[model samples]
Target: MQSDSKILAKINQTVDRLSDPESYDLVCHEHRLGEPLPSTEKLAKIVNMIREILFPGYFGTTSLRPNTIKHYMGVYVDELFELLSEQIMAGLCFTCKNPHEVDMQERNRHAQMLASEFIAYLPEIRRKLVADVDTAFVGDPAAQSQSEVIFCYPAIRAISNYRIANQLLKLEVPLIPRIISEMAHSETGIDIHPKAEIGESFTIDHGTGVVIGSTCIIGNNVKLYQGVTLGAKSFPLDEDGNPIKGVPRHPIVEDGVIIYAQATILGRVTVGANSVVGGNVWVTNNVPPNSKIVQFKARETSFSDGAGI
Candidate 1:
C-alpha cells in the first residue's frame, strides 16, 4: 500500500495529464463565451410537448376537452416555441465557424423566427402523424385500433420523431435535428436519418434493427420490417482518398414496396413500385416494378442411421 501523500500526488499527476489541452484538442468543443450548448433534456421535453400537441389526450398531463383543446394547444405551442428557439440558437452557435464575427442578437432573432415558422407547421405535422397512425392500424391485423397503435407502437414513436426531425432538417437547423432523431433511435432500435426522404404512409413493422441511410428516397405507402438495412454498399472516394460526402449511395424504394425482415438493400439501386423483397435476401441491383425477390430453397440432406457416414 502507498503512503497517503504519495497516493494524493499520483492522483494529482494523473488529473494534470488528463486535463492537458494537447490530450483532447482534436475532439474538444470550445464554444463562444456566452453561447449556450444544446441540451438533450430540453430537446426531450420539446419532443414530448410536440407529441402532446400532435396527439391531444394521448400524451402529457392535461385532460383535454373539446372546448379547451384550443387553449391547450395555445399553451403547448407557446412553451414549445421558447424551448425550440433556445435549442435552435444553441445549434446555430454550435455550427458557427467564426462566433466572434457573428451577431448574437441577430442569430437569436433568426432562431425565434424559425421557431415561429415551425409552430405554424404543427398542423401539417399533425396531419401526417394521423395518416401514419391510420396506416399502422389498417396494415396491422393485430392492432386493436388507431388509438392502440399510437399508444403502443414503437414504429409510431420512431416515425413521429423522424417526421419532426425531417422538417427541422428541411429548415436547415443544424445539430438539433440529428439530436432529436438520435433520441428516438436510442429509445427505439429504428435509425432513420433526418436527411432521408421518406414519403407519407410509411410503416415499419417490428421496427427494431431497421436502418434507413441518408440520401435514401423511400416513396409513399412503403413498408419495412425488422432487421432491414437500406444502406450504402461502398463509398466513392475523393482524390485525396477521403470518402465523398453527399453522394447517393443508398437504395431507393419506390411506392408500394414491401421489404421483409432482415433484408439488406445496398448501393444506389432502385426497388421499383409494388415490389416485394423477401426475408434475409441481399440485394445490390435494381428490382423491377411489381417484382418479387426471395431467397432460394435450402438443400435437403439425408442421414444414415443416426449420423452421416
Candidate 2:
C-alpha cells in the first residue's frame, strides 16, 4: 500500500506540473526518429565487396564461380546504388539549412549518375593501382608477390581507395569522398586527404602513421616510409586570429624523391626531383634536386643490433 501510494503521489505531481500554465506553454514538440545512417565500417565493407567482385581475388572473399560472379556483382551494385543514394541524400539534407526545400529526387539522380561513373572508372583505377603495387613490390625487397601487396600493404589500400574516391570528389558529388577517405583512414591508419594531388608510381613501405595533408602535390616515382608526414607548418591567421582555410599548405614533392621513416616535411616548401630525405629529419626549407639529407652524428645500425648504445 505504501509503494502504491508513493507511485500515485509521483503520478499526481507530474499531472499537476503538466497542468500548470507555464508548463503547458513549455510542452512544445517531440518525436522519436528511426535509427541513424549506416556506419563507415559497413559502408567500407560494402565498397570492399564491390571491389572484390569487380577485381576478383583482389580484396574480400574469393570463393565464386565464373557464372555466379556476374550475378553477385549485379546484386551488390544494385544494393550499393540504393544505400549510397540514401546516405548521399541524408548528407545533402544535413548540410542544407532549408532541408524541406531540398529535392531528394535531384540528389538521388545525381548520386546514381556519379555512382555509375565511379563504377565505370574502376577498370582504370585498377590499372593505375597495379602500378602502385608494382612500385611497392620493386621498392620493398621483403614484399613477395602482387597479391601480397594487394592484401597486406596499407599504402596500396589507402591510395587505391583515395584515387577512386578522388575521381568522384573531382566530379563534386558532395560528402561521399570525405566519407570514403575516412573509411580508408580507419582501416589502414594512413590518413591521405582526397584533395591531395599524388602522381603515378608512388609506393609507401609499412605504411602506419602516414599523413599526407591537403594541398600536398606529390609527383611520380616517390617512395615514402612509415610514419612519414607531409604536412603544413602553420596557417596564416585572419583578423580574428582564426587560421585561414584553403591556403597552399603542405609540401610539393617532385618526381623520384624518397622520404625515409619518421620524417616530417612541412610547409609549402618543395623537395626537388631525385632528392632523398633521411629518417627522423624535420625539413621546412626547399631541397634542390639530388640532395641527400641525413641527421648529424648518426651511425648506421642493423635491425637485430638494437638502436643506439
Candidate 3:
C-alpha cells in the first residue's frame, strides 16, 4: 500500500481533474441546483401503477369488484397526478438548456395540467390495448386465452409501454417518454422508439430482436413476427455531414399486412395493405397492396458418403 500523503495527493488531483470544465463538460449533464432529473426507478413504479389501474383484475393482487373499482380508480388517478407531474417537470428541466431561467412555479402548473390531460387519455389507451391483446390472442395458436395474452405476452407489455410513451411524445413532453419505452425494451427485447406512430390492432409474435425505427408509421391490423426489423436504410446528411433528424426513413406497414419472421424492411417504402411478406427477406422498396413477398427457394443438394468416399 502507498503512504497516506501519496493517497491524499492522488485523491485531490482526481477531484481537481473531475471538477475542471474542459475535462467534464462534454459528458456531464449540468443540472441546476433545485431542478430534479428524471428517475428510471420512479418511472418504473409509475408504469406499474398505470398497469394496475389499466388492468386491475389481471396484474396485481387487488380485486376489482363493482363496489371497489371506482374507489381504486379514484385513488390511483389522484396519486398518478402527483407522480407523473413531477416526472414531466423533470423532463422539461432536462431538455431545457437554461433551467435556472425557467419559472419553476409556472412550469409546475403546466406539468400538472399536462399530467391531468394524460390521465384523461387512460381510457383511450386501454381501448387500444384491448385491440392489441385480442389480436395477439387470435394471431398466435399457442395463446390459450385473452387473459394469457394480456398477462404473459411480451408483445402486450411492449405495445402498452409504446402507446403510453407515444402519447407523452405527442404531448411534447421530452426525455421521460424515451425512458419509458427503454424500460420496456430492457424488460422485453423489443425496441420501439417513442416517436413511432403505430396504429390499432397491432401484434408482434415472439417479439424479440424487433426494431421499429423513429419515423416508422404502422397502420391498422398489422402483424410482425420475431426478428422483424423496420429500419432506415440510410440517413441524409446535413451541411456538417451529420445525419438530419426527424426525416421519414423507416418503412410504412399499411393496414392488414403480415410481415413474417426475420423480415427486414428499410427506407420510406410502403408495404401496401393486405400484403404478406415472408420470412428472412430484405426489402427496400414499396410493396403493392395484397402482394406476397418471399425469398427464392434454395437449390436441393445431395451428399454422397455411404463409406465409399
Candidate 4:
C-alpha cells in the first residue's frame, strides 16, 4: 500500500543505520585488507583428512591395502599440510591486533613450519587415539570390535577432534584449535575444550551433554558417561566485573576414575585416582582416592489408617 519511492527511502535509511561503524565497532573484527579469514568448511575437510590418515581403510579409502598404505599416507599428509598451513596462517592473521606490524612472509614461513611439526607429531596422536579406541571397545560390551568403535562411536570422533585441537593449542596457533574443538561439539554434543589437559586412554560413553571445561586436567584411563559436566562453580571477577581469564577453575580428575551419567563436578576440586562418582551427584569438594560418592537414598514414609488419625 506504500509508494515505491517511500519504501525504497525507508529501506535505504535502515541500511545506512546498519552500515554505521559506530554501531558495530565493539563486536566487529577488523583485519588486514588482503588477509584471509579462517574457513569452517576447510577446517572440516582438514578434520576428515586427519581421520582418514589415522584410521586408513576405516575412514576414506575402502580399497586401501597394506602395500599401498604408504602411498595413501603420503597423499593425505601432503594435502593436510597444505590445508593446515593455510588455516594456521589465517588464524594468526585473525588474532593479530596490529596486522600492519606483522611480517606476512615470516608468518607464512612460521605456519609452514608449524604444519610440518604437526605432521611429524601425527604418529603420537595416532598412538593416543589407538589407546582411546581400545579402551572404548573394551569398556563397552556392545562394541564388537575396535574397528567398530572407530567407525560407530561418537566418543571416538569427539576425542579425535580434541586430541588434534589440543596439539594445535600446544603449538600456540590461535583460533583454529578452538574452532576444531567446537566443530566436534556441534556434531557430537560433547564439548571438550582444546585447552583441557586430557591424558591418553580416555573414553566417554553415551557422550551426549558432556562438557569438559578449559583448565581441566583429566588423568590417564579415565571414563565419563552422558550428561557429565566438569565446570567451574564460581568465577573470580575483577574490578570491571568481568571474570578473570586463565585461572585454573575446573576440576582435576585423577587416573582410573569413572564418572557416571549426570554427575556435575565443579570448581578446582580433585577427584582422586580410582574413584567412582555416582550418577546425578553434585560434587564440589576434593574426593579421596578409591572413594565412591553417591546420592543419599530416598526415605519411605508410613501412612496411618485411612482417615483414622
lDDT (Cα atoms) of all candidates against the true structure: 0.94, 0.80, 0.93, 0.95
lDDT score at residue 142, model 2, on the 0-100 scale: 90
- How far is 172's C-alpha from truth in model 3 (Å)? 0.7
User: Which 10-residue window of candidate 4 scores lowest in summed lDDT?
Assistant: 300-309
Write the number of the candidate with greater lDDT, choosing between 1 and 3.
Answer: 1
| Deviation in Å, model 2, residue 6 alpha carbon | 12
Order candidates by TM-score, high to low.
1, 4, 3, 2
TM-score of 4: 0.95
lDDT of 4 by residue, 1-309 (tens): 999999999999999999899999999987667787999999999999999998888887635788888888888899999999999999999998877788999999999999999989999999999999999999999999998999899999999999999999999999999999999999999999999999989999989999999999999999999999999999999999999999999999999999999999999999999999999999999999999999999876666775433
Stretches of candidate 2 off by over 4 Å are 1-38, 63-69, 299-309
lDDT of 2 by residue, 1-309 (tens): 579889999999999988777765655422213312435765676568656755576666665678787877777777777766665555554455664565667766776777677677777777878788899999888988877887788888799778866887777766667888888898889999999999998998988999999899999999999999999898899999999999998999999999999999999999999999999999999999999988998567667566455
Off by over 4 Å in 1: 303-309
lDDT of 3 at 246: 82
Q: After superposition, how far is residue 261 of candidate 3 from its true place, in Å?
A: 1.2
Best by lDDT: 4
Query: Which pairs of residues collide in model 4?
Result: none
Q: Considering TM-score, which of the candidate structures 2 and 4 is the better prediction for this target? A: 4
RMSD of each: 1.7, 7.1, 2.7, 2.2
Per-model TM-score, in order, reads: 0.97, 0.80, 0.94, 0.95
Residue 229, model 4: Cα distance from true site in angstroms: 0.4
